[model samples]
Target: MRKIFFSGAVLTASLLLGACSSTDSPAPAPSARASHNAADATFAQQMIPHHQQALEMAKMVPSRSSNPKVVDLASRIDRAQDPEIRQMQGWLSAWGVAATSHSMPGGHEMSGDHSMTGMMSDADMKSLDAAKGPEFDRAWLEMMIKHHQGAVEMAKTELAQGADAGAKALAQRIIDAQQAEIAEMQGLLKQG
Candidate 1:
């Protein structure tokens, strides 16, 4: 009788311990994967402005050049990045965050070169605007390579510290794909 009672207590304790462990598992990891909290909300917000700026640069290519290569490259950039903007917007909606708020993103005003990658400054935009023929193509390639490099850096930062898996996955993809594009742009510049 004593042996059976002792064994029953042990079995009950084991079941209770198992239940406690399973409940705790749901809290930390699942919170990290889907949906938004502060980290994911901030990521999409900051990334929207960043992506919008890149789109502007990509859109400028066709009118600025007659070079088929430059035109093709510009089109590719536009096609790739425009959807990112929309996707990020969707993320913001799903996360219950406002895409545009009265305040600036990541808690600061996002002006100047340091805030974004491959972002064309006022003078850079002017230069591209005025450039024509081979000059236009060369300038576009050089500037875009620098731009893509900037994006690669930003993506790396997101992968390191970002919380949401979806956002992290997208960032990793950008880093891989943009690095390849940067290499291609470098090759084109060298050939020029």
Candidate 2:
């Protein structure tokens, strides 16, 4: 009787364990809290060229400016923005979107149908490209401050409307960093 009872108990335990086994279906992927959206795509598209222009301006510093502090600041800007440009580019690629936006009827890109905020006009860039020494330093600082301001504005818009977690975080970083640099530039301007 004891042997029979033990065998029955073992069989029951095995059946219970089999019933508790997990299903073969794969577990669902974790839901992303902040996913891509129109605003996120727009932000990346606008910011890429904006960062590129800043790099262009920074490159001009070494050859054109005499101020050590200004040159150093420009170097910092160039270093910081290069990676950010690549990052934005990666985002565009991952989303399967074009790096450049559709041109408006007037040859402009983006919704405004005019200029992107903080982008220097071709003429303005040309002027900076021509300047040298003190003039170059002054032009570089003033234009960059304006450029940074425009970036901050664009970033703020992203923060307000953007949906992607990564994009929104990047926007906030731009705002914080550029705003601090703007204040530093303003102080430098006051000194000279």
For TM-score, the strongest prediction is 2
lDDT per model vs. reference: 0.74, 0.87
Query: For model 1, where is the 10-residue window of minimal lDDT?
Result: 24-33
Q: Once model 2 is optimally superposed onto the true structure by TM-score, how far is the C-alpha of residue 23 displaced, in angstroms?
A: 19
lDDT of 2 at 78: 92
Question: After superposition, which runs of candidate 1 have C-alpha atoms over 4 Å from their true positions?
Answer: 1-34, 37-39, 100-114
TM-score of 2: 0.78
TM-score of each: 0.73, 0.78
| Cα lDDT tens digits for candidate 1, 1-192 | 999999999999999888767855444544422555565666677667666766777787777776777677778878888888799888887766788643544443364445455566767877887888779888888888887787777778777777778888888888887888888878777877
TM-score quality measure for candidate 1:
0.73
Give the local distance difference test score of model 2.
0.87
lDDT of 2 by residue, 1-192 (tens): 999999999999999877766576554454332267888889989898788789989999999999999999999999999999899888888777778786544333443324799988877888999999999999999999999999999999999998888899999999999999999999999988
Model 2: weakest 10-residue lDDT segment is: 105-114
**CA shift at 100, candidate 2, in angstroms?**
1.2
